[model samples]
Target: MEISWLGHSCFQLRGKNVNLITDPFTPQQESAEPPATLSKINASIITISHNHPGHNYVQGVGGNPRVVRGPGEYEINEVLITGVASYHDDEHGKSHGRNTIYVIHMDDLVICHLGDLGHALKEEQLEAVADADVLLVPISGGKSVTATQAAEIISQVEPHVVIPMHYHPTPDEQRPAQLDKFFREMGVEAIEPQPKFTVTKNSLPATMQVVLLTPR
Candidate 1:
Protein backbone atom coordinates (compact mmCIF):
# COMPACT_ATOMS: atom_id res chain seq x y z
CA MET A 1 0.00 0.00 0.00
CA GLU A 2 1.03 3.63 -0.57
CA ILE A 3 0.30 6.26 2.09
CA SER A 4 0.40 9.96 1.29
CA TRP A 5 -0.23 12.78 3.70
CA LEU A 6 -2.27 15.73 2.37
CA GLY A 7 -1.72 17.95 5.37
CA HIS A 8 -3.41 18.11 8.77
CA SER A 9 -5.09 14.76 9.46
CA CYS A 10 -5.87 13.94 5.85
CA PHE A 11 -4.15 10.97 4.22
CA GLN A 12 -4.68 8.90 1.14
CA LEU A 13 -4.04 5.19 1.52
CA ARG A 14 -3.77 3.58 -1.87
CA GLY A 15 -3.73 -0.12 -2.50
CA LYS A 16 -3.78 -2.21 -5.62
CA ASN A 17 -7.58 -2.38 -5.72
CA VAL A 18 -8.83 0.40 -3.49
CA ASN A 19 -7.96 3.94 -2.42
CA LEU A 20 -9.11 5.54 0.83
CA ILE A 21 -8.85 8.99 2.37
CA THR A 22 -9.11 10.10 5.98
CA ASP A 23 -10.52 13.36 7.41
CA PRO A 24 -10.58 15.63 4.37
CA PHE A 25 -10.04 19.14 5.72
CA THR A 26 -11.35 22.42 4.38
CA PRO A 27 -8.97 24.86 2.71
CA GLN A 28 -9.98 27.81 4.86
CA GLN A 29 -9.46 26.08 8.18
CA GLU A 30 -6.69 27.25 10.46
CA SER A 31 -5.14 23.81 10.59
CA ALA A 32 -4.78 23.63 6.82
CA GLU A 33 -1.12 23.77 5.89
CA PRO A 34 0.75 24.73 2.74
CA PRO A 35 -0.23 22.73 -0.36
CA ALA A 36 -3.29 21.41 1.46
CA THR A 37 -5.54 21.54 -1.56
CA LEU A 38 -8.62 19.39 -1.72
CA SER A 39 -9.30 19.67 -5.44
CA LYS A 40 -6.72 17.01 -6.16
CA ILE A 41 -8.20 14.42 -3.79
CA ASN A 42 -9.95 11.43 -5.29
CA ALA A 43 -10.74 8.35 -3.31
CA SER A 44 -13.03 5.35 -3.27
CA ILE A 45 -13.78 5.88 0.42
CA ILE A 46 -13.59 8.92 2.65
CA THR A 47 -13.58 8.76 6.44
CA ILE A 48 -14.76 11.69 8.51
CA SER A 49 -13.67 11.76 12.12
CA HIS A 50 -16.19 14.37 13.26
CA ASN A 51 -18.49 17.18 12.12
CA HIS A 52 -15.79 19.80 12.52
CA PRO A 53 -15.05 21.84 9.39
CA GLY A 54 -11.40 20.92 9.63
CA HIS A 55 -12.28 17.27 9.00
CA ASN A 56 -15.78 16.78 7.52
CA TYR A 57 -15.59 18.53 4.16
CA VAL A 58 -16.55 15.71 1.85
CA GLN A 59 -17.41 17.84 -1.18
CA GLY A 60 -13.79 18.78 -1.61
CA VAL A 61 -13.03 15.33 -2.96
CA GLY A 62 -14.04 14.61 -6.56
CA GLY A 63 -14.42 10.83 -6.76
CA ASN A 64 -17.95 10.55 -5.31
CA PRO A 65 -16.50 8.58 -2.44
CA ARG A 66 -18.45 6.57 0.12
CA VAL A 67 -18.09 8.74 3.18
CA VAL A 68 -17.89 6.98 6.53
CA ARG A 69 -18.82 8.95 9.61
CA GLY A 70 -19.13 7.90 13.28
CA PRO A 71 -18.56 4.43 14.65
CA GLY A 72 -19.47 1.46 12.52
CA GLU A 73 -18.17 -1.53 10.59
CA TYR A 74 -18.04 -1.20 6.83
CA GLU A 75 -16.66 -3.03 3.84
CA ILE A 76 -16.26 -0.88 0.77
CA ASN A 77 -14.65 -1.99 -2.47
CA GLU A 78 -13.01 -4.97 -0.71
CA VAL A 79 -11.50 -2.90 2.07
CA LEU A 80 -12.65 -3.63 5.62
CA ILE A 81 -12.90 -0.64 7.95
CA THR A 82 -13.88 -0.45 11.60
CA GLY A 83 -14.65 2.93 13.08
CA VAL A 84 -14.34 3.16 16.85
CA ALA A 85 -15.95 6.05 18.71
CA SER A 86 -13.50 8.46 20.30
CA TYR A 87 -13.46 12.09 21.41
CA HIS A 88 -11.96 15.30 20.08
CA ASP A 89 -11.10 16.46 23.60
CA ASP A 90 -9.93 14.64 26.68
CA GLU A 91 -13.14 15.43 28.57
CA HIS A 92 -15.22 12.99 26.57
CA GLY A 93 -16.08 15.46 23.80
CA LYS A 94 -17.56 17.99 26.18
CA SER A 95 -15.08 20.55 24.97
CA HIS A 96 -14.44 19.55 21.36
CA GLY A 97 -17.14 17.02 20.46
CA ARG A 98 -16.80 13.40 19.38
CA ASN A 99 -14.37 11.82 16.94
CA THR A 100 -13.98 8.44 15.27
CA ILE A 101 -11.00 6.15 15.16
CA TYR A 102 -10.73 4.07 12.00
CA VAL A 103 -8.90 0.77 11.70
CA ILE A 104 -8.60 -0.24 8.07
CA HIS A 105 -7.60 -3.61 6.69
CA MET A 106 -6.01 -3.25 3.29
CA ASP A 107 -3.39 -5.20 1.41
CA ASP A 108 -3.01 -7.62 4.32
CA LEU A 109 -1.95 -4.77 6.58
CA VAL A 110 -3.82 -3.22 9.49
CA ILE A 111 -3.72 0.59 9.31
CA CYS A 112 -5.15 2.65 12.15
CA HIS A 113 -6.09 6.31 11.92
CA LEU A 114 -6.60 8.01 15.29
CA GLY A 115 -8.68 10.98 14.14
CA ASP A 116 -8.10 14.07 16.21
CA LEU A 117 -7.65 11.89 19.22
CA GLY A 118 -7.26 14.12 22.28
CA HIS A 119 -6.41 11.65 25.00
CA ALA A 120 -4.76 8.37 25.75
CA LEU A 121 -6.60 5.32 24.57
CA LYS A 122 -8.95 3.47 26.85
CA GLU A 123 -8.70 -0.29 27.27
CA GLU A 124 -11.41 -0.85 24.66
CA GLN A 125 -9.81 1.56 22.21
CA LEU A 126 -6.48 -0.17 22.65
CA GLU A 127 -8.13 -3.51 21.99
CA ALA A 128 -9.81 -2.14 18.87
CA VAL A 129 -6.49 -0.97 17.39
CA ALA A 130 -4.29 -3.74 18.74
CA ASP A 131 -1.40 -4.88 16.57
CA ALA A 132 -1.75 -2.06 14.09
CA ASP A 133 0.80 -2.11 11.30
CA VAL A 134 0.71 1.63 10.71
CA LEU A 135 -0.67 4.22 13.12
CA LEU A 136 -1.72 7.73 12.01
CA VAL A 137 -1.64 9.92 15.12
CA PRO A 138 -2.18 13.63 15.80
CA ILE A 139 0.89 14.93 17.63
CA SER A 140 0.22 18.68 17.56
CA GLY A 141 0.13 20.33 20.99
CA GLY A 142 -2.91 22.54 20.48
CA LYS A 143 -6.33 20.94 20.43
CA SER A 144 -5.08 17.36 20.20
CA VAL A 145 -2.76 15.34 22.43
CA THR A 146 0.52 17.00 23.31
CA ALA A 147 3.88 15.63 22.17
CA THR A 148 4.58 13.87 25.47
CA GLN A 149 1.12 12.34 25.55
CA ALA A 150 1.50 11.23 21.94
CA ALA A 151 4.81 9.52 22.72
CA GLU A 152 3.19 7.67 25.62
CA ILE A 153 0.31 6.63 23.44
CA ILE A 154 2.72 5.37 20.80
CA SER A 155 4.40 3.24 23.41
CA GLN A 156 1.08 1.72 24.40
CA VAL A 157 -0.05 1.03 20.84
CA GLU A 158 3.38 -0.11 19.65
CA PRO A 159 2.49 0.06 15.97
CA HIS A 160 5.08 -1.03 13.46
CA VAL A 161 5.06 2.43 11.79
CA VAL A 162 3.90 5.60 13.52
CA ILE A 163 3.10 8.69 11.39
CA PRO A 164 2.54 12.01 13.10
CA MET A 165 -0.02 14.43 11.64
CA HIS A 166 -2.18 17.50 12.34
CA TYR A 167 0.85 19.66 13.02
CA HIS A 168 1.68 23.23 11.96
CA PRO A 169 4.21 22.76 9.22
CA THR A 170 3.89 26.28 7.87
CA PRO A 171 5.32 29.37 9.54
CA ASP A 172 2.56 30.18 11.97
CA GLU A 173 3.56 32.70 14.58
CA GLN A 174 1.21 31.35 17.21
CA ARG A 175 2.37 27.74 17.10
CA PRO A 176 5.78 27.94 15.49
CA ALA A 177 7.03 24.55 16.57
CA GLN A 178 6.00 21.94 14.02
CA LEU A 179 7.05 18.31 14.55
CA ASP A 180 10.02 19.43 16.60
CA LYS A 181 8.22 19.04 19.93
CA PHE A 182 7.08 15.56 19.06
CA PHE A 183 10.52 14.62 17.82
CA ARG A 184 11.99 15.85 21.11
CA GLU A 185 9.51 13.77 23.08
CA MET A 186 10.52 10.77 21.03
CA GLY A 187 14.21 11.53 21.87
CA VAL A 188 15.14 12.01 18.21
CA GLU A 189 16.89 15.12 16.96
CA ALA A 190 16.17 14.59 13.29
CA ILE A 191 14.52 12.12 10.93
CA GLU A 192 14.70 12.25 7.14
CA PRO A 193 11.28 13.16 5.77
CA GLN A 194 9.91 11.20 2.88
CA PRO A 195 7.50 12.35 0.20
CA LYS A 196 5.29 9.32 0.68
CA PHE A 197 5.39 5.98 2.49
CA THR A 198 4.98 2.67 0.73
CA VAL A 199 4.97 -0.66 2.50
CA THR A 200 3.70 -4.17 2.10
CA LYS A 201 2.86 -6.75 4.74
CA ASN A 202 6.20 -8.45 4.20
CA SER A 203 8.16 -5.17 4.40
CA LEU A 204 7.06 -4.41 7.95
CA PRO A 205 9.76 -4.49 10.60
CA ALA A 206 9.61 -6.53 13.78
CA THR A 207 10.04 -3.44 15.96
CA MET A 208 8.24 -0.08 15.99
CA GLN A 209 9.62 3.02 14.23
CA VAL A 210 8.51 6.60 13.60
CA VAL A 211 8.17 7.95 10.04
CA LEU A 212 7.72 11.61 9.27
CA LEU A 213 6.04 12.17 5.93
CA THR A 214 6.30 15.43 4.04
CA PRO A 215 2.78 16.46 3.10
CA ARG A 216 2.26 16.70 -0.63
Candidate 2:
Protein backbone atom coordinates (compact mmCIF):
# COMPACT_ATOMS: atom_id res chain seq x y z
CA MET A 1 0.00 0.00 0.00
CA GLU A 2 1.04 3.61 -0.51
CA ILE A 3 0.08 6.58 1.66
CA SER A 4 0.78 10.31 1.40
CA TRP A 5 -0.10 12.97 3.94
CA LEU A 6 -1.77 16.05 2.51
CA GLY A 7 -1.48 18.11 5.70
CA HIS A 8 -3.74 18.13 8.77
CA SER A 9 -5.89 15.00 8.98
CA CYS A 10 -5.93 14.64 5.21
CA PHE A 11 -4.17 11.70 3.55
CA GLN A 12 -4.27 9.89 0.26
CA LEU A 13 -4.01 6.11 0.18
CA ARG A 14 -3.51 4.16 -3.01
CA GLY A 15 -3.21 0.43 -3.61
CA LYS A 16 -4.57 -2.28 -5.92
CA ASN A 17 -5.41 0.32 -8.51
CA VAL A 18 -7.78 2.15 -6.15
CA ASN A 19 -7.25 5.61 -4.64
CA LEU A 20 -8.82 6.72 -1.36
CA ILE A 21 -8.57 10.26 0.03
CA THR A 22 -9.59 10.94 3.60
CA ASP A 23 -10.69 14.04 5.54
CA PRO A 24 -9.63 16.68 3.02
CA PHE A 25 -9.76 20.31 4.11
CA THR A 26 -10.51 23.58 2.39
CA PRO A 27 -7.78 26.19 1.88
CA GLN A 28 -8.95 28.26 4.82
CA GLN A 29 -8.58 25.43 7.28
CA GLU A 30 -5.42 25.01 9.32
CA SER A 31 -2.86 23.27 7.12
CA ALA A 32 0.90 23.09 6.85
CA GLU A 33 0.60 23.43 3.07
CA PRO A 34 -1.29 25.83 0.88
CA PRO A 35 -4.23 24.61 -1.20
CA ALA A 36 -3.28 26.43 -4.38
CA THR A 37 0.12 24.76 -4.13
CA LEU A 38 -1.34 21.25 -3.90
CA SER A 39 -0.81 18.99 -6.85
CA LYS A 40 -3.90 17.89 -8.71
CA ILE A 41 -5.42 14.71 -7.25
CA ASN A 42 -7.67 12.08 -8.84
CA ALA A 43 -8.91 9.61 -6.29
CA SER A 44 -11.23 6.70 -7.11
CA ILE A 45 -12.93 7.23 -3.76
CA ILE A 46 -13.19 10.33 -1.57
CA THR A 47 -14.23 10.02 2.07
CA ILE A 48 -15.45 12.73 4.39
CA SER A 49 -15.53 11.80 8.08
CA HIS A 50 -17.78 14.42 9.59
CA ASN A 51 -19.38 17.79 8.95
CA HIS A 52 -16.41 19.80 10.25
CA PRO A 53 -14.92 22.06 7.62
CA GLY A 54 -11.44 20.80 8.28
CA HIS A 55 -12.59 17.25 7.61
CA ASN A 56 -15.25 17.82 4.95
CA TYR A 57 -14.24 20.31 2.30
CA VAL A 58 -15.71 18.30 -0.58
CA GLN A 59 -14.85 20.91 -3.21
CA GLY A 60 -11.07 20.74 -2.70
CA VAL A 61 -10.35 17.41 -4.34
CA GLY A 62 -9.40 17.97 -7.99
CA GLY A 63 -11.11 14.87 -9.32
CA ASN A 64 -14.71 13.79 -9.74
CA PRO A 65 -14.09 10.91 -7.37
CA ARG A 66 -16.83 8.59 -6.15
CA VAL A 67 -17.62 10.26 -2.85
CA VAL A 68 -18.60 8.53 0.37
CA ARG A 69 -19.95 10.37 3.37
CA GLY A 70 -19.46 9.20 6.91
CA PRO A 71 -20.92 5.94 8.38
CA GLY A 72 -21.23 3.36 5.62
CA GLU A 73 -19.57 0.45 3.80
CA TYR A 74 -18.60 -0.17 0.21
CA GLU A 75 -16.12 -1.81 -2.11
CA ILE A 76 -13.96 0.19 -4.44
CA ASN A 77 -11.68 -1.68 -6.81
CA GLU A 78 -10.48 -4.61 -4.70
CA VAL A 79 -10.48 -2.83 -1.35
CA LEU A 80 -13.17 -3.38 1.28
CA ILE A 81 -14.15 -0.11 2.93
CA THR A 82 -16.05 -0.26 6.22
CA GLY A 83 -17.20 2.86 8.02
CA VAL A 84 -17.31 2.35 11.76
CA ALA A 85 -19.30 4.84 13.83
CA SER A 86 -17.47 7.00 16.38
CA TYR A 87 -17.62 10.48 17.88
CA HIS A 88 -15.80 13.81 17.69
CA ASP A 89 -16.52 14.56 21.33
CA ASP A 90 -16.17 12.53 24.52
CA GLU A 91 -19.84 11.81 24.12
CA HIS A 92 -22.26 13.19 21.56
CA GLY A 93 -22.88 15.96 24.10
CA LYS A 94 -21.62 18.95 22.13
CA SER A 95 -24.18 18.94 19.26
CA HIS A 96 -21.68 17.03 17.10
CA GLY A 97 -23.44 13.86 16.07
CA ARG A 98 -21.40 10.80 15.10
CA ASN A 99 -18.10 10.47 13.27
CA THR A 100 -17.05 7.67 11.00
CA ILE A 101 -13.69 5.94 11.04
CA TYR A 102 -12.86 4.02 7.92
CA VAL A 103 -11.19 0.62 7.73
CA ILE A 104 -9.76 -0.18 4.34
CA HIS A 105 -8.18 -3.51 3.49
CA MET A 106 -6.58 -5.18 0.49
CA ASP A 107 -4.45 -8.29 0.08
CA ASP A 108 -1.38 -6.57 1.48
CA LEU A 109 -2.45 -4.14 4.18
CA VAL A 110 -5.28 -3.14 6.45
CA ILE A 111 -5.44 0.61 6.97
CA CYS A 112 -7.62 2.40 9.52
CA HIS A 113 -8.46 6.12 9.46
CA LEU A 114 -9.48 7.61 12.79
CA GLY A 115 -11.55 10.52 11.59
CA ASP A 116 -11.52 13.23 14.21
CA LEU A 117 -12.17 10.57 16.77
CA GLY A 118 -13.08 12.52 19.92
CA HIS A 119 -12.84 9.79 22.50
CA ALA A 120 -11.24 6.48 23.41
CA LEU A 121 -12.54 3.23 21.99
CA LYS A 122 -14.53 0.60 23.70
CA GLU A 123 -13.52 -3.07 23.35
CA GLU A 124 -15.86 -3.37 20.37
CA GLN A 125 -14.29 -0.38 18.73
CA LEU A 126 -10.87 -1.89 19.33
CA GLU A 127 -12.03 -5.11 17.67
CA ALA A 128 -13.37 -3.15 14.73
CA VAL A 129 -9.92 -1.73 14.12
CA ALA A 130 -8.06 -4.98 14.81
CA ASP A 131 -7.35 -5.76 11.17
CA ALA A 132 -5.52 -2.53 10.54
CA ASP A 133 -1.82 -2.92 9.93
CA VAL A 134 -1.31 0.78 9.48
CA LEU A 135 -3.41 3.04 11.67
CA LEU A 136 -3.91 6.75 10.84
CA VAL A 137 -4.64 8.56 14.10
CA PRO A 138 -5.43 12.12 15.18
CA ILE A 139 -2.85 13.61 17.55
CA SER A 140 -4.54 16.84 18.72
CA GLY A 141 -7.00 17.06 21.57
CA GLY A 142 -10.36 18.92 22.11
CA LYS A 143 -12.30 17.72 19.08
CA SER A 144 -10.55 14.39 18.87
CA VAL A 145 -8.98 11.84 21.14
CA THR A 146 -6.18 13.16 23.33
CA ALA A 147 -2.59 12.04 22.69
CA THR A 148 -2.78 9.56 25.56
CA GLN A 149 -6.14 8.27 24.38
CA ALA A 150 -4.73 7.78 20.90
CA ALA A 151 -1.77 5.89 22.34
CA GLU A 152 -4.04 3.66 24.37
CA ILE A 153 -6.12 2.93 21.30
CA ILE A 154 -2.98 2.08 19.35
CA SER A 155 -1.98 -0.39 22.02
CA GLN A 156 -5.42 -1.94 21.93
CA VAL A 157 -5.59 -2.18 18.14
CA GLU A 158 -1.99 -3.35 17.91
CA PRO A 159 -1.43 -2.00 14.45
CA HIS A 160 2.02 -2.72 13.07
CA VAL A 161 2.44 0.95 12.30
CA VAL A 162 0.71 3.91 13.93
CA ILE A 163 0.89 7.12 11.92
CA PRO A 164 -0.04 10.25 13.90
CA MET A 165 -1.75 13.17 12.19
CA HIS A 166 -4.24 16.08 12.79
CA TYR A 167 -1.77 17.97 15.05
CA HIS A 168 0.57 20.72 13.94
CA PRO A 169 4.25 19.82 13.90
CA THR A 170 5.62 23.37 13.81
CA PRO A 171 4.34 26.37 15.74
CA ASP A 172 3.10 28.48 12.90
CA GLU A 173 0.50 31.25 12.77
CA GLN A 174 -2.26 28.69 12.22
CA ARG A 175 -2.77 25.77 14.64
CA PRO A 176 -0.73 25.11 17.76
CA ALA A 177 1.89 22.34 17.63
CA GLN A 178 1.13 19.10 19.46
CA LEU A 179 3.33 16.42 17.93
CA ASP A 180 5.73 16.23 20.87
CA LYS A 181 2.93 15.38 23.26
CA PHE A 182 1.74 12.70 20.86
CA PHE A 183 5.23 11.20 20.61
CA ARG A 184 5.68 11.14 24.37
CA GLU A 185 2.42 9.34 24.96
CA MET A 186 3.14 6.86 22.18
CA GLY A 187 5.46 5.05 24.60
CA VAL A 188 7.27 3.29 21.77
CA GLU A 189 9.97 3.82 19.19
CA ALA A 190 8.83 5.73 16.11
CA ILE A 191 10.05 5.80 12.54
CA GLU A 192 11.06 9.11 11.04
CA PRO A 193 10.48 9.33 7.34
CA GLN A 194 11.78 11.83 4.83
CA PRO A 195 8.21 13.16 4.14
CA LYS A 196 7.22 10.23 1.89
CA PHE A 197 7.64 6.45 1.67
CA THR A 198 7.00 3.48 -0.62
CA VAL A 199 6.47 -0.03 0.69
CA THR A 200 5.53 -3.52 -0.44
CA LYS A 201 4.40 -6.44 1.73
CA ASN A 202 7.96 -7.65 2.05
CA SER A 203 9.11 -4.23 3.25
CA LEU A 204 6.87 -3.99 6.30
CA PRO A 205 8.96 -3.86 9.46
CA ALA A 206 8.64 -6.73 11.94
CA THR A 207 8.27 -4.78 15.14
CA MET A 208 5.50 -2.33 15.94
CA GLN A 209 6.23 1.40 15.63
CA VAL A 210 4.67 4.84 15.60
CA VAL A 211 5.61 7.24 12.80
CA LEU A 212 5.17 10.99 12.44
CA LEU A 213 4.62 11.83 8.78
CA THR A 214 4.34 15.23 7.17
CA PRO A 215 2.49 16.39 4.09
CA ARG A 216 3.74 15.53 0.65
Candidate 2 per-residue lDDT, tens place, 1-216, comes to: 678888888888867687778988778757645375243777778888887777777667766777888666788777788888888888663756788889987657888899988888877777888988889998788778888888888888888877888876554533244666676676544446446555566777788867656676
Per-residue lDDT tens digits for candidate 1, residues 136-213, read 999876678888899998999889999999886665433336577888888876787798999999999887788988
RMSD of each: 3.2, 3.4
User: In candidate 2, how many Å is residue 65 off?
Assistant: 0.6
Give the Cα error of residue 161 in candidate 2, in Å. 0.5
Most accurate candidate by TM-score: 1
Question: Where's the lowest-lDDT run of ten residues in candidate 2?
Answer: 169-178
TM-score of each: 0.92, 0.88
Candidate 1 local Cα displacement, residue 184, angstroms:
2.0
Clashing pairs in 2: none
**Judged by lDDT against the true structure, how good is candidate 1?**
0.87
Off by over 4 Å in 2: 29-34, 37-39, 93-95, 171-177, 188-193
Model 1, runs deviating above 4 Å: 29-36, 171-178
